[model samples]
Target: MRRIFILIIGIAVLYSCRNKQTESNNIVKAIAQDTLSKTVAGTADVGDVSPKNDETVKLIQKQLKVLLKNDLKSMTNEDRYFYYEAFDLNNDKKDEYFVGFSNSYFCGSGGCSGYILNHDGSVINSFSVTDFPILVTTDSSEKFYNLLMKSGGLFHLVKMKNGKYPSNPSIEEKWKGEVPKESTKVLDIYEKKLEKYSF
Candidate 1:
């Protein structure tokens, strides 16, 4: 009788331990599944945007807003407001625009970077630069410029030119350590576009 009681107690303990281990594993699996589901659902929402010619600009702006909202969740409203700037690039007689957002405090750090839509609300092209870019106006031409601190003291100055689609990019200029070199022809092209749009 004593031997039988000891054997029963041992079996009960072993069963309890095995059940607890299985429960813990199930909890971990549930958490992983939930995370994966959320990620897939978020991506699907972005993909649903219609890429029609007429709707492209609106869609791009909407996407930018969604991305910024998600990425800058930790920022206060005022801080978030200072992070983005939008403007038209080309003189296509349409209101093409560029939108830029900074992820770091001030404008130059690890963060988000992109271009805005033209009047047609379509994205022309976009490239990423380290740090937050500031919109600078020099003698009437406006551009998106940023400094890459991680690089060997190089500055990237990007200008959007107004012209037909699929043509050579209007202009993409890079300057190092100082003000960009000014070219009369480049200025003239910008001025021409500005004048055409100003009226």
Candidate 2:
């Protein structure tokens, strides 16, 4: 009879522990959801830019995990933070992703790093020594919009050549020309806002 009592107690304890774990998991999920909601607040339903879209968000996060697999191992908690904005760079009415990392590990004296991803999260281009507020100009190359990225305190015109932007902006010529009319600045403070995301 004592053995049976001990068995029941063991089962009960295990069940209690599982319930507590489940509750903890739920709390974590709740916190994540709350953060996501705040991150996407005041954003319009234009495209997959909304973090409320769980599937798209999950897919983007998964791709980032794979893309930054090596860097992830050495990244500190601060380096795990990222920000992104979606814009139709190709003018297909579909948004391509512009993800930026601003932490010390990703930044240097020249500038930081950013990734331009296609609609499906495939990397279209990865640029080093790049500064934010990526400008989408009215100019076109290979049927895609040209970009003006700041590096070394000067704007570099990043025209799509052979289907990719220059991997390093520090070597590109400075943008001496005027930003075309109707051009938009993405990830800027006033317009084309960025959404903070934790990896």
Candidate 3:
């Protein structure tokens, strides 16, 4: 009888150990799955974090129609793609527009043309041979935020001079140092978000 009791106790102990091991494996798997889900959610949130304001977009379109009047007349609807974002460069509590062209007519081997417009749709600055991920740093030049644009595989530190950013980025000075932590990418957008000009 004692031998049978001993055997029963041994069986119970073995079963308990097996259950504990199974529970531990289940917990590990649950944690791993949770981590993976969070990573995917974070990645999906990346791209053009600024608020979508239809009024600002309309203003940009109005200005673009006049600015590219001649070019628009010659190009097809397929080549009318562009990207834009609104950001405050100065401390005036008003946002300025950043527009970039992606089509062949506006882009070349070096890069594409970008424009900065005021809240009233007036062109404030124009940039040529510019690439995306336009970085705006905390440092200001003449009360306007400094810009970092890529052209020809190099980054240019374009500063506001005499109330205007440089029109030609290829001729500007290159930024050799690391990018500033406070720099904000004001113009980066997904391909699907590119605005198609109705005109």
- lDDT of model number 1: 0.40
lDDT of 3 at 126: 83
Number of clashes recorded per candidate: 13, 0, 0
- Candidate 1 vs candidate 3: the TM-score winner is 3
Candidate 3, residues 7-40, lDDT tens digits: the string is 9999999999999999999999997777566445
Q: Give per-model TM-scores.
A: 0.33, 0.69, 0.72
Higher lDDT: candidate 2 or 3? 3
lDDT of 2 by residue, 75-151 (tens): 88888877777777776988887878777998899888878889888999899998777778767899998888889
TM-score-based ranking: 3, 2, 1
- In model 3, the clashing pairs are none
lDDT per residue, candidate 1, 44-142, as tens digits? 111122222425434554655565565566666544532122332333445444444433432343334445455644566554443323333333333
RMSD of each: 19.8, 12.4, 9.4
Query: Clashing residue pairs in candidate 2, if any?
Result: none
Tell me the spans in candidate 2 whose CA falls farther than 4 Å from its real position: 1-52, 189-193
**Candidate 2: TM-score?**
0.69
lDDT of each: 0.40, 0.77, 0.79
Measured by TM-score, how close is model 3 to the native structure?
0.72
Superior by TM-score: candidate 2 or candidate 3? 3
